[model samples]
Target chain A: MIDEKGILFILSGPSGVGKGTVRKALFEQDTNLKYSISMTTRTKREGGEQEGVDYFYRSHEQFEQMIHEKKMLEYAKYVGNYYGTPRQYVDEMIEKGHDVFLEIEVQGALQVKENFPQGVFIFLIPPSLEELKNRIVERGTETEDLIINRLKEARNEIEMMDKYDYVVVNDNIEDAVRKVQSIVQSEHCKRSRVAKQYKALLEVDDK
Target chain B: MIDEKGILFILSGPSGVGKGTVRKALFEQDTNLKYSISMTTRTKREGGEQEGVDYFYRSHEQFEQMIHEKKMLEYAKYVGNYYGTPRQYVDEMIEKGHDVFLEIEVQGALQVKENFPQGVFIFLIPPSLEELKNRIVERGTETEDLIINRLKEARNEIEMMDKYDYVVVNDNIEDAVRKVQSIVQSEHCKRSRVAKQYKALLEVDDK
Candidate 1:
């Protein structure tokens, strides 16, 4: 049992690429990963969500106070509500050797990267842009106005992939989840992550 | 199906870490891996070895000429025999999109690193120095004089971890193989490896 520092894996992609779907699938598989639930100022839908499970629902003032106190790892304002990852939980989880997984939007993820650049950033993409458009159309939730805008944003979001460490094509949920799982497993094996432990082992041997 | 360039995975470790055993176990699995047999001038064993499969057995003059012509990827002379990996087969296999696996000694692996630094270098370590010494002793093939020498060399080789990209502790055969497999899969998902292809996808989308 080598007690190494845990890694932070941030899974982010363009809108409507099924980040939530993949994240749920990943967590469903009994893994050692801890899904760090984000705190948001958005109104929780009645009976559809639980406090601190779906999200840590906070009032506008409370969310702003976290920003002022520098307690949020990364937060952004969207659609008149504030959403962010709390720094305390992430730090605590990692210090205890549990990997913290964050599913966030593209902008929020970039902000998190600025603060914690070493986090493994995985960019989830659709199989193709045409398929992406199809998915956007198939969802049917967005009326005429928002579909075009979301599709254009998704196109621009593909360019943001340069900031990621790994890219998983969300062709289907199972394959995408497997790729993410592999990335996490592989990150733990990196020499950069575990070199110090081995070096220390040798030092003990020498003594 | 993304037709991407293959990754080169180099597996090397100290003596008695069972590099050959682990490599064989890995190849036995139904993986897409292609093992690149090393070219050596050393005499093939009485019956257990095959030319081209075990090694591309060659003569001292031919091996030396290959070194002179700079065709050898990495080579080192041991016990009066030249053992080296030929650059030609490695190049051809990689060019054809086959992930080439090379099981080499530490010295030869370092030489290969110098020549082709992009290769994923995995250092297979024994569970512990105590275990390593025990393994060397249990083999019982070495006379008293060679035993001490081999143990000291293995100890020194642990310091070579700095030169490697990942280190897999060879506590058991199956776990070591699994770790190596994950590393290869992760390498495939690397952003640097597939960024060009994704960027080209964006270009196509734009057109």
Candidate 2:
């Protein structure tokens, strides 16, 4: 992939589908990918959620300032908290031929698609709708009303997956990670991406 | 891939680019793929090339008859010998959801493209054109004119790679095989191929 612009890989899915777990597993193995840390105005979780590693902690005022300055590639408000991907860092890394990995919610992912239309969008799904419901139910703390609402939201998000380029059935972490890695590998070999390079290299006029 | 029709994977490149070696290496590790052994009118090579294993050797008259009967998927005459893929066997295997792998010449690969346009066409390339010429020259058996002619033929084939879906630089056998395997893995995840199944499975009206 040297001298070629690195591809942007966006992994997104509905809530409670283990996107975070799968993303963690994928990164544990693929050192070649640069994780694009997201900026958030929400409070970071207590357990080892360091700034820049888990999320770039920011004040609401600063988050709005970034939006006003056209700094964010995509942003969404969840529970009155600002969450967005920084544009400059991703653009700089990919320009240096380093593939950038982004794990986000469905809304932010769709927004990112508007800016980086050529980016590879992967939708992670539970094995079945029944499996998704079971996972939500097993969490055990949610009231019946909350559980029903989450399922309804999930159904809506599933419909939006038509916009994605690949779907990884998160039956397990290893398989999901492997499929994602294969997608990255295959995208690098895509004819549309590499054809010009090969043509330029081998189309000698020595005939 | 169960219940889904198998994909045809075509591995092709200019002569002396080592398509055969990479195909062998790929099959040795990935048994999920079924190699579509080609048929030929040429006499089997001396070193243990078995009938139906290496190739289904046929007489010139029989090969022509099969062609006349439209039994061949794609065929080309090489060095006065007719070589072609058996259409019936490949179709049966793919219908049963077994991926068929075909390693073939550039001309014949293009012919197969016309027939199975959905097939994944991967064009293997040498590290450099000079490297391709070096490989041919290192054989040290062909006349200088023959080597020049082969290089010219290779140049033309490389140009035809625009018709392919993927281009793998065969710098070494291992890397080439890995790239091909990745393509198969990723193709199985393509939205055009799997979206309907996912939509049906997840689209519930229980809201």
Best by lDDT: 2
Q: Taking the candidates in order, what DockQ does each have?
A: 0.64, 0.58
lDDT by residue (tens digit), candidate 1, B89-137: 8888899999999998898899999889999999998877777878988
Task: List candidate 1 segments past 4 Å from native.
Answer: A43-49, A205-207, B42-50
Error of 1 at A121 (Å): 0.5
Residue pairs whose backbone atoms clash in candidate 1: none
Task: Please write out the lDDT profile of model 2 over residues B43-65, one tens digit for every residue.
Answer: 98998999989899999999999
Candidate 1 CA-lDDT value: 0.88
> Going through the candidates in order, what is the number of backbone clashes in each?
0, 0
* Highest DockQ scorer: 1
lDDT of each residue in A1-207, candidate 1, tens digit only: 477888899999998899999999999993899999889998899878999898999999999998999899899888999888998889998999999999999999999998889899999988777777788889888887798898789888888989999988899999898889888887887888987897678557755
Best by TM-score: 1
TM-scores vs. true structure, each candidate: 0.94, 0.91
